[model samples]
Target: MASSAIKHGELVALQELDSSSPLFKQGASLRVTGKLQEYCVGTAIATIVDGSVSLKIDTQHLRDLNFRVGSIYQFIGELLIQSDTDAVLQARVGRNVDGIDLNLYHQSMHLQRQFEVDYMRTRTT
Candidate 1:
């Protein structure tokens, strides 16, 4: 199938050998796991180029999920698997746990500060 013919959200198997029409086919949702690598924060693009699959991720989403480079994640996301060497991921479901405790602690502190600011603003107004 022509890569252009594939819909934006259409799912295709990452491996060229996969030909199962039912379990693996076009437009089917698939969960893939891969390590995060080759990313550009300025462009908001991250790539997971593996032996069987390749994925592209939005760094903003990664940041929201506290994903870090060199970390592994599971993505239940949309795919445009054009070929064995070409594919794209539009979303993901999981993130890296490296430094997660520290990250969460910082996040909690930030949230507490925001809550305090909001409370003060409301009281003043």
Candidate 2:
């Protein structure tokens, strides 16, 4: 039977994992539930890589949900934790499910940044 809560991993605060701890390491699977922050609601999934958070949301989802930053989200998956470097957590993602796609997030971020730059350049005399 499938349980609503994550059985293999432990429930932990996002902030706690965001902090420094020996518990954070490679092969470490953690379950974190917190308000969505930093990413838009369209972000159905997200992941941690090199100590950075990335979203795995799509354009259709973005328009449908219109997610805003600072919203809460739940994360559960494995981490490639490393000392002296940021840990990367691969989140399981799906519609109404938990997970993250790093590649998608990077592409979105790049496009967004490019658009911003283009806008700024065009506005400049």
Query: How badly does each model clash, as a count of residue pairs?
Result: 1, 12
lDDT of 2: 0.47
C-alpha local distance difference test of each model: 0.54, 0.47
Candidate 2: worst-modelled 10 consecutive residues by lDDT: 55-64
RMSD, each candidate, Å? 14.7, 16.3
**Per-prediction TM-score, please?**
0.45, 0.42
Q: Could you give candidate 2's per-residue lDDT for residues 34-98 as a string of tens digits? A: 33444433444443222243422222222234334444444556666545455655565212223
**lDDT by residue (tens digit), candidate 1, 40-89:** 76876677634545567644544366556777655565555666544455
Candidate 1: which stretches are off by over 4 Å? 1-26, 51-53, 58-63, 81-85, 97-125
Candidate 1 whole-model C-alpha lDDT, 0 to 1: 0.54
